[model samples]
Target: MSDFMTRVLRRETHSPRSGWSVVAAILVALAAIYALLESVLAALGQPAWLVHPLDALTWIADLPGPYPQILLGAAGFLMALVGLIFLGNGLLPGRRPRHVIDNPRVAIVVDDEVIASALAKCARVAAGVTREQVMVVVSARLVQVNVRPTSGIRLSEQKIQAAVESQLADMELDPRPAVTVKLASSGVIGV
Candidate 1:
């Protein structure tokens, strides 16, 4: 039963650009359908109830002589631009769901929110900061920590940075992101 020994593994999937792609595709498709319906209705001598909006579209045909050519040229250019945008989007890689780590047998995939929360907890404990004063953002290449100091309390940037860096180092994140510490100019009123 060599066939029964196969391993089945599934990777997390993400469709970051598919949303915009679908939207652009829908817009193009709707435009084509509208034109087709209008043309069919007009050819068959059907009443203009559903076609009322299409009547407004006659501006393309009614463009005054030279203006018609100019308008059509502009329209063609706009359509081409939209098509190019869609093409670029299709060609580029979308948002990746998870980052690949070093180990081939095992993988570590972490979400931004989770990373931010962990960093916030660490920052609060390490810097003696209140949860309200700590904010974190984890991007692909950076982890930003913004600290709004509590009133009447002074905070040390070095200790916070060291603590955060140590914690991140312990985690052993692949493609480890750089850490940025930003201290707010004014402390919050209450805590």
Candidate 2:
């Protein structure tokens, strides 16, 4: 089962987009901009002066009657449609189910140089994980750094978690901290 899952998860190394996709994306972006400008003008009860001047210039070309407005409107609409299609494709929901980890908790029992360094850095910046609050315990090859916050700031939880995770990821650590927030006082936490 593990081998089968590994085979299913493996991906081929290749660039994702083709040249045509890039061209299509550019066309779509132009259309979306046109639509947005048109909508804004309509909302503000203002005439589309920018488009009007262009239309006036095209009108002097002496093309078939009413052809200028038709051509310009069609072009704008086509561009907007293409942009919508591209956006829809990019933002559409995925079919695959995400992998959820049951036990994300980290138990550091040993004081290795790498782990200790990470913990110290996390403790220093973390409002919750003070020097005294951090407890380093070791058991065989495992090392756990238990952090307890002295302040009841909620922002500390997210900040400390992100900091610790980012630091560990930078060091190429396999498992990151599963930060648990414990409040010491009640108050509004700023992000």
Candidate 3:
């Protein structure tokens, strides 16, 4: 329990709440404060500055026929939508930027960019291809490696796949993501 709290307090916490969630909370707090202030001012028979700017609300109330009904229905719908947004934001987990290889015990957190770049470097070195020819994209569960050979060069996909697999094995990611090697249909002219 203490460890979990510590993680939340840390700046680089793994799964913290989104900024919009905090904004929603602040808005609710401000609304509550305004309501309390207005009530106190009305009780004391004092001039409420907050109430003055809100004279437009009286105009809205005086609206004739279906105008008042329509306005209120729209306002209610908007408020309901906002409530739903806030509820969803609070309930849903954030899109974690870093993957947790080992959690709680060792707590190894690695960024997606780091994994992709490392895979790209390893693929380039193993395949003897220039940086432009090899493109690597690393996700939570998959590593896609695309290789494009120069004209007249027939690069073996098996060799490239094995090299990438070896690199992945060496890293030993916790979740153990799959690797895929694809050869471009047409070779590049210069690169």
Candidate 4:
């Protein structure tokens, strides 16, 4: 693929900006506005909304001097913890747990759940089992197929794994995942 197409595919497959970042931004903006309003009120010799800016500054300046050192330390630690959490959310790459299919004409980004459903369908057909009998879970690097065979019917784990692998190969997923098939020890009664 061309450079532009590659970039577009990468962006499309990855997740968007973190919601926590947006929330943090909104909260900061609100706090700033409140502080500005309080400052203006204090300058005008009017009643403050929450606390006068000067009084607030004084409280912060006092810090651990008069207050219990443990309490002040805990408050500071909590604030630092929240700031770190927000910073991490902003800096971290939020990649979606999705698979990308390379197509010559179009970029295809598939959700893990959709991939799992497709695998389940393929497993059901290969094993001649009902929908409920086959369960597929798709992860970034693994595809797990769990099958409960009908009573008196012997199931081949290799066959199911091979079928799931074949379907995955056909999809041409980027960073193709490994496949594993697990059969339950006890089978359910066939309807």
Candidate 5:
């Protein structure tokens, strides 16, 4: 299987939630609709107060005419501006690229038996190496392994090198061996 496909299959999927911007846009859309309706009612010769509470309040207060229409137009414009900002943010760069995976940490892609056998042999040949101290991770085309050895079982780089190479060779795969080792937590190992 392709590396991308494998990763997808093994990954945990989650449902996405709409952001606050979506909510804001919906509110703005409602406000714009109210503005359009109020304008239409005014054009049809209906009293503005009949369609808008704010217009009725203005009329009760004996406020000068045209104030309500002006307020509604300003409100509509502001709502539209807010909605545009939300939409722009949702589309702009640095706001989460559509295709890229975020913060990918590990890639697991090796047969378990191969890894187990490799680990077992490495532990057996090296005195301090133990199952618990080893962490085997497989990637698309490579295997990464971390090993921690118990105290007092000193190992040298040459010894570790020779042991791992020998164990991998014993696996009898066509590609022979593909493993590397690094000192993880520290136990004496010759460098």
Candidate 6:
């Protein structure tokens, strides 16, 4: 692939994974600052800011029998869980809720909300219903359209489905999403 295509594909599909790292860094910095403050207070013969380091170490060492064992086990488990969470976030690709529009010259990515809104509009027009009567959800693999017909009026499911499908075709979305249209059992009074 060309450089332009590669850049566009990377920018559109994936989000930055540095958020967790930033949070971890901030926590570590805060802990370091607290430790420094405690050390300074101890050296000056002043009361410790929190627990003195020596006292904390002595308490851990003096803890009796099964109590220490249980505490250590729980601490280990908590650390392992935190490590796994960070590892998973770092390793997995952060994909956005977006669809790609393929063009020979340039890449275009559209947010799912934009696609849903467009399909909702199409369904509303096809069903002859107001905006509130139609709800559309566009996801990576599916476009679901739910419509409530105007009370006392009949609606055609096939017609609405066809309109939505036609609109999807016009969008030329890459990895085309499946379309499903459902009419609600009860209708709202027509506005």
Residue 174, model 4: Cα distance from true site in angstroms: 0.6
Worst 10 residues of 5 by lDDT: 94-103
Q: Clashing pairs in model 1?
A: none
Regions of model 2 farther than 4 Å from truth:
1-113, 136-145, 151-155, 174-191
Top of the candidates by TM-score:
4
Candidate 2 residue-wise lDDT at 87: 73
TM-score of each model, in listed order: 0.64, 0.28, 0.66, 0.84, 0.33, 0.75
**Candidate 1 Cα outliers beyond 4 Å, as residue runs:** 1-65, 68-77, 97-104
Residue-level lDDT tens digits of model 1 in 47-121: 663654456667546666566677778988998998888888888655443443334555456676787889899
Distance from true position, residue 95, model 3, in Å? Answer: 4.4
What residue runs in model 6 are displaced by over 4 Å at the alpha carbon? Answer: 1-3, 39-47, 60-88
Cα lDDT of model 6 by residue, 1-191, tens digit: 57889787877878887789899899999999988898888999999878997887788798664576787789889999999998988998777889888777777889999999999999999999999999999877899999988889999999999999999999999879999999999989766
Clashing residue pairs for model 2: 108-143, 108-144, 109-137, 109-138, 109-142, 109-143, 109-144, 110-142, 110-143
Those runs of model 4 whose alpha carbons end farther than 4 Å from true positions after fitting are 65-78
Tens digit per residue, CA lDDT, model 5, 1-191? 46775446344221123665578678889888878888787788786744565565568587445567788678889989977876766665322111222233643333545555565557545745555666655332334455666666555645666666676555443223366666666653433
Q: Model 5, which residues run further than 4 Å from truth?
A: 1-110, 187-191
| Per-model tally of clashing residue pairs | 0, 9, 0, 0, 2, 0
lDDT of 4 by residue, 124-180 (tens): 999999999999888878898999999999988888888889999999999799999
lDDT scores in order: 0.74, 0.50, 0.75, 0.89, 0.55, 0.89
Candidate 6 yields a Cα-based lDDT of: 0.89
* Candidate 3 residue-wise lDDT, 57-175, digit = tens: 77657665456678778988999998898787778654455454544445466777887788888888877778999998877678899998888878887888888888778776755
TM-score of 6: 0.75
Candidate 3 off by > 4 Å:
1-13, 18-21, 46-85, 100-107
